[model samples]
Target: MRILLSVLALMFTLGLTACDMNEGPAEEAGENIDNAMTDAGNAVEDLCEDAKEGMNAEDEDC
Candidate 1:
């Protein structure tokens, strides 16, 4: 049991150290964020189209 605990602790420490490593440069991060925003906008546009279709169908039924 003690050995298992020590191994777990060592693994946790190593994982923490890995996370501490420097991330990608700011420029790349900005570009990735911009791409994510564009994707989100496209998704929202598709949802709006779906809502419009539903509203039109409802109008036809009434």
Candidate 2:
């Protein structure tokens, strides 16, 4: 009985590990989203700076 119980417990632990293995793809997708957002934010900031520079004289506040 004890050996059977131990075998069942081991199988259950392995099953959970198999489910956890799928998290790698999710983590990778999350990282990709994060990088895209950062790039977009940077582009917006650069455009804002360019607009400000275009509207301002050499010594005036924009």
Question: TM-score: which candidate is best?
Answer: 2
Candidate 1 segments exceeding 4 Å error: 1-24, 57-62
Candidate 2 ranges beyond 4 A from true positions:
1-23, 57-62
lDDT of 2 by residue, 2-59 (tens): 9999999999999988886555777999989999999999888777778778888473
Q: For model 1, how does the per-residue alpha-carbon lDDT over 5-54 read when each residue is reduced to its tens digit? A: 99999999999988865667986899899999999998887787787787
The local distance difference test score of model 2 is 0.83
Give candidate 1's whole-model lDDT: 0.82
**lDDT at position 40, candidate 2:** 95
TM-score of each: 0.50, 0.55
lDDT score of residue 54 within candidate 1: 78
Error of 2 at 4 (Å): 21
User: Which candidate's lDDT is highest?
Assistant: 2
**Model 2: how large is the Cα RMSD against the reference?**
5.8
- Which pairs in model 1 have colliding backbones? none
